[model samples]
Target: MNAKPLKIGVIGCAGIAERRMLPALVADPDVEVTAIASRDGAKARQFTQRFGGDPVAGYDRLLERSDVDAVYVPLPPLLHAEWIERALRAGKHVLSEKPLAANGKDAAELVALAEDRNLTLLESFMFLTHSQHAYVCEQVVQGVIGELRTLTAEFAFPAKSADDMRYNPDTGGGALTDIGVYPIRTALMYLGSDIEVIGSWLHVDAARQVDVGGAALLGAPDGVTAHLTFGMEHAYRSQYALWGSSGRISVRWAYTPPPTHSAVIRIERQSHVEEVTLPPEDQFANVVRAFIARVRCGVPSGLEGESLLIQADLVDRVRARALIRPAR
Candidate 1:
């Protein structure tokens, strides 16, 4: 017998929810988006009209729905832990957007709540669900890259809009919390969560009162090192490289590749180069499937909670250590 589709509700009608997440959820056979809610009822109604879900007046109303088996929280970082806690208390499984919380303490608290309730609470690190990353991990583990020595990643884009939430410090907005977390998490995925931040620098837009860009150097006691650079205002760049003793692996379009874009992983060793091109994948859909599998089929989330805590802690340390300079 086939398992039933998981009924889902969305807590916010953010751009990500409308552009990327809704389409991915709608395309998945294992999910049924039962409801959508936004602070603006009209926006919620419009989202439902386009996305195929019941329109709820507010988030609390959506949480009160008996038919909503799970909720996807796409709120900003500052609001993630609050609504995630509310959704869990309302007896709904949750898949929250990344940076799970503003800091490590809040993230740990939410994880504990989810554990206490036995609900599947997943942080939406959609890129990690993509096959390209899996292939890279497998190749590295099997010594295709030999013993790992260093990792370098950069994710940045120009966000010149003053109204963009990423420029608002009160909203947990900064390069470290926004784009920086990607490289930090990717480093942890390969180098383990025991890494420490040894050196850091940040550029802050004093007028905007937020971090626009920064670089961090992380080192594991075992000698593995990761260099991460991220920003919200800069030339477009999203990629990472893994440098090992024998060979090196590089991934292009590492973080935000579209569902239909082919991913290329380049391997170089001994004056020879090989390229592994992976077919398009809907990572958001994969995340939904994984969430359902864990919630309904009793599959585990595989140490994501611990990794989230580590990521949050490292973000805190980086922010604390970095020398902030006013952006010109």
Candidate 2:
């Protein structure tokens, strides 16, 4: 690791990067946003200028710059694997936005390629870096909720414009890909990856060419079960609940950033009830710190082959079996 700051080039001057990653990078003292790129060069220039950086015409141009040591790929889901593979082959470390790829097979290929290239490849599941999630994990282990028996998670948000990429199946748009991944990720994280998905149901929006809502039931061989749901055609709601033999833990808005949202984990023993409140912190900042640490210290982003492969396979299986119908 060098004493000088590591240089980063951002791909996809889109909503998530513009709203979250760019601001966080500019604020971090340990890293420098040296360049930005997008299919729309003007938008890339605007973002780079706004953040006091240089603009590259496209991702390939940015990757060619020897000064850029790493790249952030926040592009649409379908584009994730291709660009990630390209970045690694270009000898640049990559911090990518989640789902790793449109499916599990692609994720495995990318991971293998990055490993061969000796470059970091991480899925940006930022919530895992947040203290709130740590607090929840600690309570679960502390038996504040007793033996974990059941878990439930729900995430929903209003649909985007009719023509947005999120509504385009070609780009891997769907409620499951958008908001559902969080709950499914949480379930896998908390219950462990050995769990089996018991049953699932998905509803598609023919109008938008993606899913509008869906749910799944999962069970672990170790006596744990989870129910998860996600939707893009509903009032905004994000929540998760974990139940145990003696009590239950709940987060009001689980997935999204809520720096000040306090949650209660209720513990009920034979004749007593206890409520534990969890304070929140800046998740985006935490993710940046974690990624930089990996860049500096050479640690993998905790996204290795096994778990991500399981997640990808689960998603693929669920999508394949889902009884999808054309929009009504």
Candidate 3:
């Protein structure tokens, strides 16, 4: 028996929705792009024209649509808490972009609200859904990495324009919240959520009070450690490595890869080095499917809430203790 596709509404017509998410949603048989909303009618229309959804003039209007079972919120960091609350209260499941809130306290509040409402709330850390990571976990569990000791990850790319929203502090613009969260969440994935912030460093645009880039040191009580570096001011890098007692595992493209990108995991042991190439996958589509499954099953609280709070806490810690370097 076939199930009806989950009818989805997209809030905020950001570039990511146009470039990555909408295409993935329309391609998935389990998802129906029911509506797409933007303040600019023309912008919403452009997305609907390419993606096969009805254009909505405003986010509030999209949320009111009973046809939408779930919504994907890709709005700016400052706008997340407000819109997510409204969507959940409207009885819609939410899948939001990362850094779900500006801090841990706010994130916990949102989690509690969703729990009380019995709604699914998930953060979009798309990399975790890729098959390559599952394979990495398999290797670690199989002793291929020989008792994982330390993990290091870095995810950075070129900087945005001066007037970009990423540079606006009020909009939750900063390298840490934007790019740094990737490696931080990756550490929480491998090292456990109990991970603590050892120390951090940030390059701040003093006048703007925006963190341009930074690195964080995280450690678990079990002696495992993860060093993460991320920023929008550097050349491209999307990778992480796990070092163990006997061998090491490295992924050349760990974080964000296009749907057609084949992920290569390299294992180096005392005897030899091997490269495992995974078939290309679209993690964006994978996450969308996962969201649909959760919505259909009416999964209760804690399916992904605990991790969201943990990630939010770590980001706050990094920002709190960062050794700031003024942007030049």
Candidate 4:
């Protein structure tokens, strides 16, 4: 017998939800967005009209509904842990936005709660679902890039508006939490979790009381190194390159690519260069499918408790060693 469709309640109406996530969920046949909630009732209503689902006035009320079997939380980082805990206790599976919690301890706690309840709690890192990333990793393991020496990833864009939530420290705002975590997470994917922060630097916007940008150097147990750089106030750049003894591989449009955009991966060895083009893929849709599978079929997506714990711990270590500098 086929499993029932997964009923999802959206807990936040952020831009990501409207632009990418909601559309993806709506297109999937095995999933249903039963409800949507935002701090602003009107915004929730707008989202429902544009997408599908009933608009809920408050997130708590949405959680209390028996119709919702799961929740998609796209709220600010600071509120992730609290809402995740509440949703789990309410018997709903959770898929939350990244930078899982404000700190590692809280993230660990959320993971424990989910495990105890036998519920799926996944961090919404959409890029991980993209086929291009897996292709890159496979090539590295196949020795196409020879012995991996260094991996460098950068994600940055200008956010000068004061109204932007990324500039608000109270909301767990910071370049590292907002965008830097992407490179760090991707680095961990290739370099393994047994990595250490060797050096770090951060630019702080004191008036805003947030880290606007930063760079971190991580050393893997195998002597491979990964360099990560990110900022909310800088020229746009979103890419990562892997350097090996024999050659180098670079991927453009590494993160935040639209569903219609094709990705290009370049490989260079000695004097020969090769470019691999991948077809358009909706990573958000992939994530929704994976979440549904885990909830309904007990399929593992490799995004379990240990992965969240390791990611949170690495983020904490990078933040701890960051030397704060005045924002440019």
Candidate 5:
């Protein structure tokens, strides 16, 4: 609490911003929301009215302010690289929504730029900061799951509105980048980045020319493996599990649990099955605090830069190796 509060501005009032992100930023004592920008003046005004920040009609104007030391970008994936680079060049730290960019190239460039300028660049993988994940890791390490053999994850939801940007290819809309990264990043977390992509597949939405569903297989050196399935055209399933020799540990609502929702772990062994429920946590708020703490440390470049690069590279590799299947 001794460190000065970081003054931050937002680049867009996207739904994720309203529902999960902005609320957390506004509540954090170490973060000051200087402005909230939107292309629509009225929408910007509405967010400002609720969040107590200045209403900015344009994204660029918010970047020019002296009071702003950081920026939070909740824009589409295609726009991430552009604005992130601009914010860094403007001498402002950046926290962008997951995926970082549509490709690894842009992600690498942005990470290097942040390092060169000694700025904080974070990808908002809020779930990773939640206490539930750490607890899960602890359980795994404590031999509750025995010798880890496999990790599997599923993160998907039903179709969006007819006009949702996710159905459009131009916005970097696809199951892989939009939802698949949750499991892929989690895979890297447990399996390590050195894991190789064994096989993959992407089901393309014929009319939209974008991927709607897919799965990938990844293998690690120590006989551990990961199986990931993600989609935008399926029944809602946000969960992952770790299977060891003697038992398995699984989680429900793993990726996007509501703040009031408690963490639940389902464990299965040869003898019995049990459930372990932990306290509720708002991952969105926890991630914002982690970002604030990283900034306060005054480190030139944090682990986030490396995380972004590997995560993006893994995404690229999955796409390159995936077998194309038509949603006919």
Candidate 6:
């Protein structure tokens, strides 16, 4: 028999879903959007109409639905943990956006709940779903960058606005939490465990108290140093380069650039250079499909407490070290 359609609800009908998730999901043939919620009732209704889905004013209404097998929690950073826990308690799987939680403690709690309930709680690091990242990791393991010595990645996009979610301290706004997490997590994804934040610095707007941009130095267990930089006050820039004893590999437009959009992966060996074009794909769809598969086949979710804990731990440590906190 064919599997039932994966009934899904979306929270936070704001930026990321409207721009990225909605379009990607609507284009997906495997999933169904059952409901949507937003703090603004009118906006929620309007967004539901726009996206061709059911509309509810509050997220609680969506959570109450027995048809919603899974929920996509795209709320601001501070809101992730609470809603995720709620979704788990409601017996719904969750595909949450990055940073996992407002802090490590909350993230640990969410992980524990997901574990106790045997629920699928995934952090939506959609870029990691792209094949380019895996390809890069393969090259690294193959010694394309022999004895990986260094990693440098940067993500910078112009500030959307002071009122934008990225600048709202109450919503967990900061360059580190926003874009810096990408490079930092990317490093951890490839290098394995024993990652430590050696040192860090932040440049903040005097009035807003939000970090406009920042940099971090990470040390791996094997004597590799990764330098990561993120800025929301500048022009668009996203790239990563891994350097080692024998060679270096670099990816331009690493994170936001679409996989099928004709990006080049350059591998520089001591003697020659090799550039390859990566396959294109909708990574968000991949994430959704995975969630649907797990929900349908009675299969286990790949996401686990240890992984979420690691991500949360790193993000929490970075925030603490940099001394960035939400405004009162």
Query: Model 1: clashing residue pairs?
Result: none
The superposed Cα distance between candidate 6 and the true structure at residue 150, in angstroms, equals 0.7
Q: Model 5 over residues 169-260: C-alpha lDDT tens digits?
A: 99866889899999998898888879899999999998898999999999999989999999988999999999999999998889999999
lDDT tens readout by residue for model 3, 1-328: 8999889999999888888988889999989999999999999999889998899999999999999999999998878988999999999989998768888898999989998998889887788889898899889889997989999999988878778878899886699988898898888878888877889999998888898889988899999999999988899999999999999999899888999999999999999999989899999988887787777785532226887887888898888988988977
Q: Least lDDT summed over 10 consecutive residues: which range in candidate 3?
A: 295-304
**Cα lDDT for residue 266, model 5?**
91
Error of 5 at 135 (Å): 1.5
lDDT of 3 at 59: 92
List, residue by residue over 1-328, the lDDT tens digit for candidate 4.
Answer: 7667789999999888888888999899888889999888999999999888899999999999999999999998888888999999999999998877988899999999998999999888888889999999999999998999999999999776778788788786688887888999889899998999999999999898899999999999899999999998888999999999999999899998989989999999998999999999988988888888788777877565788788889988999998889986
Give residue 94's lDDT in candidate 6 (0 to 100).
89
lDDT tens string, model 2, 1-328? 4478879999888788978777888888988899999878898888977986788888899989998999989988888888988899999989888878988889899888977887777788777776666778888999987899999999888777777777778876677876778898888889987778788778887665678788888898998999988887778888788888887777765677655656555556677767777665667777777778876777655555566787888888667767775544
**lDDT: the better of candidates 3 and 4:** 4
Better of 5 and 6 by TM-score: 5
Error of 6 at 202 (Å): 1.4
lDDT of each: 0.89, 0.80, 0.88, 0.90, 0.89, 0.80
User: Could you tell me the lDDT of residue 275 within candidate 3?
Assistant: 97
The TM-score between candidate 6 and the true structure equals 0.93
Better of 3 and 5 by lDDT: 5
Q: lDDT tens digits, residues 1-328, model 1?
A: 8888889999998888888998989888889999999999999999999989899988999999999999999987788888999999999999988878988888999999998998989988888888898899999999997999999999999876778778878875788887899998888888897888898999998888888999999999899999999998789999999999999999999999998999999999998999989999888888888888889877765435676787789888988889888877
Candidates in order: C-alpha RMSD to true structure: 1.3, 2.0, 1.7, 1.1, 1.7, 2.6
**Model 2 ranges with Cα > 4 A deviation:** 259-275, 326-328
TM-score of 3: 0.96
Residue pairs clashing in model 4 are none
Model 6 scores worst on lDDT over the 10 consecutive residues at: 319-328
